[model samples]
Structures are given as C-alpha cells and as structure tokens.
Target: MFGPEGPSLRELAVQALSSVEHGYDLLAPKFDRTPFRTPGAVLDAVAGALAPAGPFGDGLDLCCGTGAGTELLTGLCHRSVTGVDFSAGMLEVARRRVRPAGGPGVAWVRGDARALPFTAAFDLVVSFGAFGHFLPGELPGLFRQVRSVLRPGGRFAFPVFAPPRPARAAFWTLLGFDAAMRVRNALWRPPFVMYYRTFRLGEVLGGLRDAGFGVELYPLPEFGWRADGSPRARLVAARRLTPRPAA
Candidate 1:
C-alpha cells in the first residue's frame, strides 16, 4: 500500500512497462513514499544488532537504491560508507537524500553488483529490499562479488522476514504478485526479475556458503514472534572465510 505521496496507479503502470533502470529512475523521487523503501524499524533493528559486531572501519551498501541502508551504515561504520547501484537515477536520488552529515564519510558509485569494483576494501556490507531484483541463479555471483569487496572477517548482512503462511491473506497476495511477475517476464523484454517467493532461506544459505561465507541467522527480537514461537524476522550475517593458498 502506498501513501498519498506515493506513485499513482498510472505512474506505476508506466514504471512496470519500462526497463528496471528506467522504471526505478521514474520512481526514485517518491521511492521512500512507497512500501518499496526499507522501513525505519527494520533499519534500527539491524543497526542495533550490528553495533556489537562492529565499530567497523568502512561499510558498503550493495544495490543501495536510494541509500536507506547507507544511512544506517553511517552509524555503524567508523571510517567511510559507500552506496553502489547500477541505476544512475537511483544513485542521483540517493546522493541527494544522503548528504554527508552525521558521521562516516559517504560516496556513491554507479556499477553492477555482479562485478564489484573493489577487493577486500570494506569491513561491512549491507543491503535491503533489493534481493527480489536478482534471480535465484544470480545469487552465487552476487554473493561472491560482495565477498570480494569485504575484508577478512567482514560481514555481509541483511534482514529477512518470515514468509507468510498459506492460510494468511498476505500469502495469497504475494503468491499472486509473484505469479503475475513471472507471466510478465515471460511475455516481456529485458525481464524484470522481482519475485518475493523466489528467495528461499535454504537456497540462500547454501548460496552464501558456496560463495565462501560462514553464515548465521540472528533473530530480531524487536518484532516478537509468531504463534509457533518462530522469529518474525531475522538478520542473516555472512562472514567471508579467510582464503587458503594453493598447495
């Protein structure tokens, strides 16, 4: 659901019909007004959890979008923070929104996540609401790229919410949404790959492990739990393994 300031149905239609980059460019100015932006609550929860693990030197926000996660990184990282994305339009909005102010140094880069430009240059990496843009097959390369940018013992972290149960209304809604997206991609060009159901936990954990990350899940207690006592949300912290030399 969008607020009054959010994009109209006609506007959304225009975006959906365009390429991902162009679509986001059109949506950039009002991205925060939509449900698409990472919520402040989730950002605060991640920042709180990261405090103990960090006081990190520098942080990178992969696929940073309008830099909501980068804003959070400014608090956890000590030296600097960089927000990277392929969309020039999104980066432009991010640059304007995240002015170099409270704390850590800030920089914006336009690049693809599949081929990150740095090697072991960051101590922390975070992402939000951008996973849906990547297909399941792209996870390995994407994770590898993130790992390549992080220092030894550095972390790549992100929050994930529990999937809606089949009995729930939200379940049907998401299922229908993903189904529609699949149909759209099958029928369209330059396929937009956003799908909520595609990023399963098991597959993601395996992908992270394959990409040389020692992964762990931390429950976010602020959101409480489901009736079955499972956490409503969790933070996935994946540490890049120290490389071993060949014999």
Candidate 2:
C-alpha cells in the first residue's frame, strides 16, 4: 500500500534483508509516504484522549521515528518535547520535520530505547508503531527504560488496536506475516524483529505492572467498536509509581 514516493519492491526487498536499524535508516526518508507511518487520524484521536489527562509539562517520544507522535506532544505538553530514536537517519529527518515554527520546543536525540539516558526527566512519554521492532523478551527492559525517564506519577502512553479474530482475513494475513518473519530471522543476521501478532494486550499489561506502572486503558472512540461490543482501539496509560528507597 505504498505510494509513488514510497519504496519500490526491489528497495523493500533490500531493506528486508538488512538489519532492523539499517533497514529503517534506508527507509527513513520515505517512511511517511508509506502506510507504515502511524496515521494522522490516530494521532489526533490520541491527542484528544491525552488532553484531559494532561497539561503535561515536559514530554518524551520513545522511538519517535520521523516524529509523528512528537506532534501530539506539542499540543499536550507545555514546556518541551524530545524525540529519541536509535537511528541517526531517522533522527535527522525528525529534526528537520519538527523544527520550531512557534510550536512547543523540540529536540531529537539518538540513542537506544532500552537504555534511555534520562532519569525522572519527563512528565509524559508516548510511542507509536515501534513495538513490533522489540521482541517479547525485551519488553521488561523497554518498559523499565520508559519508566526510568518519567517523573513520579508521570505516564507512558500509546494506542493499541484490538487483535483480529481467527475468522477474519486480517488475522490470517498477520499470522502468515509473523510466521514468515520467524523463518526469515532464523535464516538471517542482525534479525529484523517485527511481528504483528506478538504484542498481545494481556502480556503487555503484565509487563507494565512488572515495570512499576499502575496501568489503565481508555477507549478511543474514533475507531468505534467491534461486533462483539469491545472497543476496537484503546490508549494504554501506564503511570510510573514513585521509587522505593533501599531498606
């Protein structure tokens, strides 16, 4: 579902064969042109939900990519917004795209998300579309790093879509994609670790609790509900608890 400006089939094949970071570096310039970028509609809905939860001070966008989620921070946060990503190429594009045009201040930092450098430095943090890059075993460290960057009672938020049912074509498509990815990684180096079906809500909630967050979910009304009456999408708000002193 890529546009004329998006990566060609040959280009995508090359990227799929490379390491995750290197593939993204090559894709950074045209990322927004592809369906892979988080849609503006989702961003707007998230911003609306977060507005009542906020008036947040400083914000961080974990794995910000080209800064789509960073744009949401501009409206919710008052002081400053920082977009941190491991890819220098992505950060370079984020820097250029998020330049201050009388908006909330923006900064782009290059670093690994699993080892965030800030400690209690942010009032809020958010991510989008980047979870697939992290394996299930990495969730603990990843959530811990996000928690480490937040002020006491600060939130780490992101939107999650409900999983497709087995009867649906979408479900089969995702299952096949994940299975192929597993086969590819098994045969490749620096493994491109994206799997659409792996980040289940139950598992993620458990991980958030383990990482010291009091977790809650808020429905995103924009996408409506499924036939079973459950919300089709939700915002996962994980508030960091105050750290306990060593006994």
Candidate 3:
C-alpha cells in the first residue's frame, strides 16, 4: 500500500493480474493517490511549455486517465477539450472530479486510443505518462491515430523524461520491473502490458515522421539537465503537416 488512501498491496496484486482496462477500472478511484498518477509539477511544466503556441481551438487528451492532461488542456485550448480513454471507470471519475473554471468546455469519452473515433477535429492533442502501456510495434499506428484526429498543422505533444543512466540504481529498478512484467505476462492470462524502456525517443520521432508529423523537441528547463548535460525532460511536439494544395 502506498498510504491509507492508496490501494493496498493486495489490490495492486489483483490489478496486476487483470487486463489493462479492467485493472485501471479497479484502480481508478484511488489512482490519483498512487504514484502512477502524473504529477502536478509535470503537468504545470507541460502547460507552461505549450502556452506559447496555444490558446488552441479544440483539444484532445489521448488515453486521458482521470483527466490530468485533460485538465491542463482547459487552460491551453480555447474552444473545447475532450478526454478519451477505454476505461469507463476512469472516465466516470474524471467527469465527476475535473471541473476547471472559465475555460474550454470539457467532455469525457470512453474509447480505444489506437482506433480513435474522430477525424481532423482537434487543434491539439496531448498525452502524458500513457505511452508505456503501448508496445513498440504499436507506435506507427498510435502516431497515425493521433495525426488523424488532428486538424491540418495541429500539434500532438507529450513529455518524455531522460531515461536513467545504466549505472544508476533507478535504471536497474526499471529494468527489473520490466523483466518482472515480461515474466508476469508470459505466465498470466489477459496480460497487463506496461514496460518503461520500450518507447525510445528516436523510434518515436521516426514513427511520427512516418505518420506525417513535423516533429520537434523542446527542453523542459524546470527539470534541469542530466549529468551528460542533456535535458532531464523534453517535450515532443509533433505537428500534423498540412497537405499540399493540388497543382
């Protein structure tokens, strides 16, 4: 258990045994109390980074579990904000919990991210701490889904933290977690697929390019730089390229 309000260790074990959707459903109520929720600091940094290009029209928060990113969108987007996720339980919680004053209208939709429901609708799309649920092979399709919903020249953005150095204890911790997950999935039915190391930055940029995005990366100076002098966190801003006019 993380704390009195957080899920007990037994609940986490049960959730780990369940499929991703069902597991999230079971955890949705106490999810924010757990360490898994995206931190407010991260959300604030993202909002600050995005404010310059924004006051965007419509926005979509992909896989918007409990509306952390969706809440941030209210301040950035001008017209409307939508949060979509496959878990109804999460959406229910998001609907009741997130209510920002004097911003864009908000809506919660339950749907799969890979096969998104809209086409060319939103001016901006953002996801946070959700990429690890997807496998590496799913990146192309996932990026395409994000691009498809974006208006011409619309942006799809997310933050990626610098991976821990190999020598660091954090690195081994993540490695061990991934290894345990692999073994768990290998033995369990309806696998809970969450792996931290699979989503590499280079592969993601390439996937965005293949999906017709003009990708850019901006350092989030709030997190400071790593020992190698690279940023500790960077926001990936992949804009959907406008189609050329017919000659």
Candidate 4:
C-alpha cells in the first residue's frame, strides 16, 4: 500500500487479475494516492513546456485516468477539454475529483484508445502513465487512432522518462516486474498488460512516423540529465503532418 488513502495489497491483487479496464475501475478511487498516478512534477513541467508552444483550441486526454493529465490539458487548451477512458469508474472519480476553474470546460468519455470515437476533433492530444497498458504491437493502431482524432497539424504529446541504467537498482527492479507480468499473463485470463521495457524510444518514434507524425523531443529540465548528457526525462511532441485519407 502507498498510504492510508491508497489501495491495500489485497485490493491491488484483485485489480491486477481483472482486465485493464476493470482493473483501473477498481483502482480509480485511490489511484492518486498510488505511485501509478503521474506526478505533479511531470505534469507541471509538461504544462510549462507546452504553454509557450500552444494555445490549442480543443484538447483530448487519451486514456485519461482520474483526470490527472486531463487537468493539465485544461490549462493548455482554449476551448473544451475531454478525457476518454474505457473505465466508467475511473471517469466517475475524475469528474468528482478534478475541478479546474476558469479554463476550458471539461467532459469525460468512456471509450477505448485503440479505436477512439472522435474524428479530427482535437487540436491537441495528450496522455500520461497509460502507454505500458498497450502492447508494442498495439502502438501503430493506437498512434493511428490518435492521429485520426487530431486535426491536421495538430500535436499529440506525452512525457517519457529515461529508462533507468542497467547499473542501477531501479533497472533490475523493473526487469523483475516485467518478467513477473509475463508469467502472470501466461497463467491468467484477461491478462493485465503492463510491461515497462516494451515501449522503447526508437520503436515509438518509428510508430509515430508511420502514423504520419513529425516527432520532436523536448527535455524536461526538472529531472536534469544522465552522464552521457541525455535528458533524464523528455516530452514527446508528435505533430500530425497532414490529414489521413477519409476512411
């Protein structure tokens, strides 16, 4: 358990056994107290980096859980901001918990990210802490969906933290976590699909490019840099280059 407000060990176990959507539904009420929620530091850094680059007319938060990143979108978008997720429980918590005053009006939708319902509706799309739920093979279709939802020349942004170095304790910890997930999936139905190592930077860039995005990375200075001068955290800003063919 993370804290008094967070899910208990048994609660986490029950959630993990369910499908991703239902799992998040179970965890939604206490998600903010868990480490799984995107931290304020990352959200604030992203907002600062994006505010200068945009006053996007409309925004969407793909896989928005408990409205953490959706709140971030409110500050950047000039018009309405929508948060979409497959879990009704999570959206319920989001609508109740997040109240950003005097910015864009906010709404929540229940839908899957792989096949989002909107078409060229948002000027900007953002997500946080939701990628690992998607398998690497799902990236292309997922990126295509995001591209479809964005207007021509619109941007899809998300923050990606630099993976911990192999020499570090965190690296082994993540490795162990991923291996356990693989084993768990093999033994379980509805297979909770979260793997930290699958979403590499190179593969993701290629997927975005294939989905018609011209990608760029902005360093998040709050986290500093690695020994090789690589940024410890970088924001992926993928701009839609043109409209997809009508389908």
Give the best candidate by TM-score: 3
Point out where model 1 deviates above 4 Å.
Answer: 245-247
Kindly provide the TM-score of model 2 when superposed on the true structure, using C-alpha atoms: 0.96
Model 1, 62-170: lDDT tens digits are: 8999999999999898899999998898999999889866688899999989998877899999999989999888899999889889999999999999999999999
- lDDT for each residue of candidate 3 in 1-247, tens digit (9 for 90 to 100): 2889999989999999999999999999999999899999999999999999978999999999999999999999888999999998899999988998888899888999999988889999999999999999998999999988999989999999989988899999999999999999999899999999999999899999999999999999999998779999999999999878899
Candidate 3: segments with Cα more than 4 A from true spot: 245-247
**Once model 3 is optimally superposed onto the true structure by TM-score, how far is the C-alpha of residue 223 displaced, in angstroms?**
0.5
Which runs in model 4 stand beyond 4 Å of their true positions? 243-247
Q: Which wins on lDDT, candidate 3 or candidate 4?
A: 3
Over 1-247, each residue of candidate 4 has an lDDT whose tens digit, in order, gives: 3988789999999998999988988998888899998889999999998998889999999999899889989889989999999999999999998798788999999999988989899999999988999998899999999999989999999999999989999999999999999999999998999999999999999999998999999999999999999999999999999755899
Q: What C-alpha lDDT, on a 0 to 100 scale, does residue 64 get in candidate 1?
A: 94
Steric clash pairs (candidate 3): none
Per-residue error (Å), model 4, residue 124? 0.5
lDDT (0-100) at residue 25 of candidate 3? 98
Which has the higher lDDT value, candidate number 2 or candidate number 3?
Answer: 3
Q: How many backbone clashes does every candidate have?
A: 0, 0, 0, 0
Lowest summed lDDT window (length 10), candidate 4: 236-245
The residue ranges of model 2 lying beyond 4 angstroms of the native Cα positions read 243-247
- Pull out the clashing pairs in model 2: none
